[model samples]
Target: MSETIIAKRYAQALFHIGQERSKLEEFESELRTLQEVLRNNQALYSFLQHPRITLDQKKQLVNESFQSFSKEVIHTLNLLLDRHREEILSAMVDQFLTLMNETKGIADAKVYSVRALSEGEKKRISKTFAPKVGKQTLNITNYVDRSLIGGLRVRIGNRIFDGSVSGKLDRIERELVSNK
Candidate 1:
């Protein structure tokens, strides 16, 4: 199976288990902690990714590292590791976060700007996009890229709207060049 699929399966199984036990929030927290640990510790990353290490050893290390986690979390980790599916940790984390956000009915939107957006600017953009996109709330993630030249890019799910001044200029230049 694909790494993303495996990871998603693991995350979904764990999310369901947590929901069944009425510990969904805690499960999300434990998964977030694990994600941070992986992000911050390169050694831990090496250990998890190293194929030379025996599966048993990796499992033991994972268990030991997250020993403080709740029983449910431990069991889920133990189960996934035992299956030798640790490589999907990153995808599992992303899927888990997505599940949490979807459960809360939060839609994600990416806002690309040439500069940092102030709170007021973000608010205004959110208000503007909310009407256009028809989402009740916007989980707007801001990105700064001077290469955009001016104006902004907005991605709402699979839709890409490029209203940037640079984009317009490029299109006009292309048309003029082609006409010539």
Candidate 2:
């Protein structure tokens, strides 16, 4: 199977376990924390992925590093390590969070603007765009793009709603060229 399929399967299994234990949010938080730790700590991530290190040593290190984590998460980590699929850890966490957000009627959105957006602007964008995408709400991540000129470009999943001045100019240019 492909790595994405494997990651999705693992994520589904974890999500199911969380549902059964009534710890969906907790598991999500833990997975996010694990993802962040792996991203921020190259040494630890490298150590876990090192072929020279034994599985027992890796498990011990994980246990020591995340002593406060629940057994379900720790066991899942050990399972992944034993299966030598540590590289998919981040992908699995992403899939898990996606599943969680979908269940809660939330969509992750990226908004690009010429300048940083205020909280009110973010909320307005979310309110205006979420319904069009069939999501109850959006978790917006704002990015400043100097090339945008003005207005905002919002991306949710695979769909992009481009309202920037540059985008409008490009569209108009294309239309003029095509009509000639």
Candidate 3:
């Protein structure tokens, strides 16, 4: 099976467990930390992926490194390591976070503006866009991009709502070209 499929399956299982334990948010946070650790440490990831590393050693390392995580989270990591599927850890965490967000009626958004947005502006954007996307709220990550010229461009999932000055100018240009 494909990696994504496998990841989704694992995520679904973990999500169900989290739901049962009423610790979905905690699990998500731990999973994000695990993903971050893997992303920031090449040597550790390589060690996990190395074929010569014994399964027990990998499990012991994971246990030592993530001693503070919940039993479920550690168990999941060990399970992945046992199966030699450590490469899919990030994908699984992503899928798990997606599931958790969907369950909580939240969407992750990226908002690009010419300058950093104030908290009030972020709240306003979240309020305006969330309903349109069938989500209760958006977890917005703001990015400053001078190329935007002005206004904001919001991305949720695969859709982008471009309201920037540059975007408007591009649209006008396209229209003028098409009219000719």
Candidate 4:
């Protein structure tokens, strides 16, 4: 299967496990901590990702590092690691969170602009979006892209709403050409 497929499958499995056990919140926190450790510590991440490392050694290392984890948490980690699918561990965790949020009817919106938005601006934009999205609840993520030149683009799920200056300029140019 494709990596994305594999990642999604793993994410779904974790989400189901969390939901069934009523430990979703705890699982989310633990996975985020694990992902953070992998992200912030280059050596540990490398050690975990190296293909040559035996599963036994990896399990030992993980056990040593996560001595405080409960039995369920350790079982979950060992199951994923034993699959030699550590590369997708972080993405799986992120996707799992996204799945949870989406299932809970919380929208994740992303606004990309040419410049940074102020706190007030974010609130205004989010307010504008919440109604349009047909949901009062939202989680907004922002990014700045100088190349966009002036306007903003908002995306939620598979839909992208673009009103950037560059986009408008292109539309104008296209209209002028079409009129000619």
Q: What is the alpha-carbon lDDT of model 3 when measured against the actual structure? A: 0.94
Instruction: State in Å the error of residue 7, model 4.
Output: 2.2
RMSD of model 4, in Å? 2.3
lDDT, candidate 2, 49-112, per-residue tens: 9999999999999999988888998898899998999988888999999999999999999999
User: What would you estimate as the lDDT of candidate 4?
Assistant: 0.82
The TM-score between candidate 4 and the true structure equals 0.84
Candidate 1 whole-model C-alpha lDDT, 0 to 1: 0.82
User: Please, what is the whole-model Cα lDDT of each candidate in the order they appear?
Assistant: 0.82, 0.94, 0.94, 0.82
Model 3, range 7-64, lDDT digits (tens) per residue? Answer: 9999999999998999988999999898798789999989988989899999999999
Clashes of 3: 0
Report model 2's TM-score to 2 decimal places: 0.98
Superposed by TM-score, candidate 4 places the C-alpha of residue 70 at a distance from the truth, in angstroms, of: 4.3
The clash count for each model shown is 0, 0, 0, 0
Runs with alpha carbons beyond 4 Å of true place in candidate 4: none
Candidate 3 segments exceeding 4 Å error: none
- The positional error of residue 20 in candidate 3, measured at the CA in angstroms, is 2.2
lDDT of residue 107 for candidate 3: 100
Where in model 1 is the C-alpha error above 4 Å? 130-134, 174-180
